[model samples]
Every structure is written in structure tokens, then in C-alpha cells.
Target chain A: MAGQSQQINISDLDVPQLADVRKQLEEELTHLTNSFSQLKQAQAKFRSCIDSVKEVAPQNQGKTILVPLTNSLYVPGKLSDLENVIVDIGTGYYVKKTRAEAVKHYEGKIDYIRTNLETLQETIQKKQDNMSVVASILQSKLQAQASDKANKD
Target chain B: MSLEARLQAASSEYARLQAELSAAVESRQRLDAQLSENELVKKEFAVLTPNNTVYKLIGPVLVRQDPADARATVDKRLEFIRSEIKRVEAQLTDYDARTEKKKDEVCLFCFPPLSRRAHPPLHRQLVQIQAQIQAQGQHTAAATAATA
Candidate 1:
């Protein structure tokens, strides 16, 4: 499918066909937009993880802290090991890494998300462009039809 | 069977196929997501030393795991997801083809093949028939006036 490229002239399509094309493009654009926002949220979560990892500094070692086991419940605990933190890589797997390694892991995730976001943005831009072109073509076809009716009358 | 019944059956089948296709696509997306996540974990494991501690979260408890074992588990997961994706993709293509065939059947039932070849679409033919009737009525009215 990727090897084949078909160029369609939108102006040649009748109003109903053009409408169908526009509807398809609109659906695709909405899906892409939803994905973009989801990716952004994921990136934000990763950034927060980096910040939380940074908070576990050497200076804060042995400091008393309130750990929330639940959203509304907090348990008082002492920071035992500041150097080693467990990082959840994904898919229910966690790895023990040093503070630096954890930060690097999050940064890597953030970078991956960033690249994906860039490509998604490009795709969204292209779809929006196609949508506008289709819209304009549809408008012109409707105008032409109306003028034809006026001429007949 | 009656044409109306056939058209109804075709349309209903098309709708069912469409629903199934969407479900398949949704699962495919989920599998793709899981695959990418496992791949990321595998990449992370690649850089880790043999001494690094790996833990698998079973329920709420974290169980210590050998790095080699964890990597093997991730590899197996990746393989499973890949196979599942392939299966879903095949099902999607099958659904796509079926839906298209059903759509064509519905269209055929809506405008029979014979009439489609001889005239315009059903709606356009209805308009033409209405115009001809009106024209005939006007002609008869004019003839009656002349005879009177």
C-alpha cells in the first residue's frame, strides 16, 4: 500500500462524492488530534516522573517523608535509599536503577514522545490542508449547480 | 425473496461487518501499543548490566527477577504481540472485503442492474416519470379546450 500513490482530482468529483471525502478526512483529523493530545499527556507524565526522581536527592536521604499509599491516605516513612530507585519501565516490569539512570530513562521516553509528536503534527497538518482543499472544491461545485439552476429558470 | 427483504439483509450485514472491522482495528491498535512498550523495555534491558536488579510487579507485590529472565519474558511478550497483530490485520482485511461486497449488494438491490444499465438512477427515473406525467396532463387539457 505504501508503494502505490494515487492522485485524485477533487474538482472532478460530484457533490456527494466530495462530501464523502470530506467526512472521511474529518474523521481522520479528529482521530489524529485525539492521538496528539494523548501523546502530550504521556510526555507530561514522563516529565513529572523526572521531577519526582530528582526530588529523591542525596541531601534528602534519611529525611522523614509522607508517602501516599492512596490518593487520600499518607503514611509517614523515612527515605531509606536515595541512590537506588525502582523505575517502572512498562508492562508491569520495574527495574532498580540509580537516580541518574532513572532520570535518563524518563528523558529517553520524553524524547521518543517528542519525535512521535512531530510526525503526528505533520500528518495532522497535511490532513487539514486536504480538508480545506476538499471544502473549497465542494463549495465551488455547489455554487456552479446553483448558477446552472438560475440560468435554466 | 423480495427486493426489499434482500436490501434489508444486505444493509444489515454491511453494518455488522463494519462493527466487527472497527473492533478488530481497535484491538490491533492495542496490540501495537503493547508491542512498542515491550520493545522499549527490551531496549532498556539491553543497556543494563547483569548486576542490575529486575522486578516484575505481580499484583501489588514486586518480585525480584533475574535480568536474563526478565529480558526473555519481554522477548516472548513481543513475539506474542507481533503474532496477534498479524492475525488482527488479516481479520481486518477480510472484514474490509466483506463489507465492500455487502455495500455493492445493497447498491445493486436499491437499483437493479437492468434498470441501471437502461436508465439513470432510481431517483432520477422517478423525477423523469413525474415530468412526463405532467406534460401529458397539460397536453390533454389543451386538446379538450380546443375541442370545446
Candidate 2:
């Protein structure tokens, strides 16, 4: 009968559920932190790329270098900071990236970064909101308990 | 004896204001459409090239221009975008200011924000005011659109 019947364990589920929420919020915080790491890496990549472009095409290099977006998504504030990190690999790399075969290779990495960023941002916002809600709930409950004690006294 | 004449004059003035509102709205719609088209063009340009790219796509872009001509075209387009943005912003500001003014003229008889006097037929007056508000909203939207 134990094998056939589904078990519905209800003991301390609500308290345990709160712990579960905390764990999820922590995970989300970690992911949000990852965005900073990616930004740093992107900055490094851009610096090296710009250096090489400056060597070959010094005059044109002084002007803005095209940072071709493989994935079309905008995360305004985060991406705006990313503007400083574009490294123009060189004319050869540019020509190769323009070539269909070479472009597809980088597309894989670009798509991953874009998707990761989107999820990370959303998780960060949601977790912060959840924490605020939980805090308010707790504050209200505490006030109610204190009021009950006062009434008895 | 000419009480009817006074009523006719008020109705005529009201009709004139309504017509002006509609014309303004139509003009705004046209402008809005133009702005939308321009925005689309800008997006397409950004995509075909790259963000923060120095050179924008010139339609059927003629290459190797005289330095002077190339510089002038670039300067002009940039100026155009700057001016267009400012113009739209100003129009929005004007609309906002006008709306705020209209709101301040709320019925003095009714307390709090929307005081429409406690007349016998409160419902009818409220309905008329509500309709006027909606029509004003449309008129504002149309005016802004015309500017676009």
C-alpha cells in the first residue's frame, strides 16, 4: 500500500518553504554577480582588439570601431557600460567575421552571453522584489503579535 | 426675446473649437507617422552595420566622396536628428503644460480635485465632463501625432 499510495508529508512545510525561498534568492544573487564577470571579460577583449586595429589603421582606428552585435538584444544600462570595451580585432579579423563561416563561430558565444545576461538581470530583479515582499510580511506579523501581547496585559 | 440668439452663439463657438481640435489631431497623426518611419529607418541602419559605428549607411552609398562633401552630409544628418529630438520634446512639454492648466480649472463647487458642484443632476454633469476629458485626451494625442 505504501508503494501504491502517494505520500503527502505536511510537517513544517511552511517553514521549510521559507528556507527554500532563501536558497533560490541566494542562487539568483550569484547569477547577477556573473554579469559583472562577463562585463570584465568583454572589456579585456575590446582592449586587445582596439590595440591591434590601431596598429594597422591608425587614422581610422581613432574613429569609432564597429562592435557587430551577433545577437540583437539591448540591456541598456549594462550594455551602455559595455561600449567602452569594444576591441577592433583588425581588418583581417573583420573580413573573416564578415565571411559567413567565421561569423557563425562567434555567433554561438554572443548568443550565450546575451541569453545569460537577460536571465541574470530578471532573476536579480525578481529576487530583490521577493525579499522586499517577505520583509513586509514579517514586519506586519511581528506588529500583530506585539499588539496581541499588549491587549492581554 | 433673443435668448435663442445667445444660445446659438455659444453652440457655434463650441462647434468651432471641436473642429480646431480635430484638425490639430489629424496634423499630429501625420507627424507621428513620419517620426515612426524615421525611427524604423534608424533601426535598420544600426542593424545592417553596428552600434557606435562611425559611418552610417548612405543609401546606395557613393564612396570616395570629396572630403568636404562627405563631412557636410554627416554633419547635416546629425544636426537633423538632434533638432528632431528637441522638437518632439518641446511639443510634449507644451501638451503637458496645457493639460495641467485644463485640470486646474476643475469645478470649484466640488471639493477635492474634481469638484463639480452638488447640483440636482450630478450624474449628467459628470458624464458631460467625462466625455469632454476623453475628447481632450484624443485631441492632445492627435496634436502630438501631427508634430511627429
> TM-score of each candidate?
0.83, 0.30
Query: Taking the tens digit of each residue's C-alpha lDDT, what string does model 2 give over A14-111?
Result: 44344444444555456557655775586556455444433343244344444535476433222223212222222111111232322333343355
- Candidate 1: lDDT of A80? 84
Instruction: For candidate 1, give the docking quality class from DockQ.
Output: acceptable
Error of 1 at B29 (Å): 1.5
Writing each residue's lDDT as its tens digit, candidate 2 over B1-148 gives: 3433433344344445545555545555555545554443333233333332322334544223233443454355556656665665566556556544544433321234333454435545545654565455544443333232
Candidate 2 Cα RMSD after full superposition onto the native fold (Å) = 18.9
Return the top candidate by DockQ: 1
True contacts kept of 2: 0.00
lDDT minimum window of 10 residues, candidate 1 chain A: A1-10
Task: Flag regions of model 2 displaced more than 4 Å.
Answer: A1-153, B1-72, B107-118, B127-148
Give lDDT per model, in order.
0.77, 0.45
lDDT for A119 in candidate 2 is 67
What lDDT tens digits, residue by residue, belong to model 1 across residues B1-148?
8544565565667667766766776787678778888998999999997656999999999999988888898899888999998898899789878866776666665544446456556546444543443343333323222221
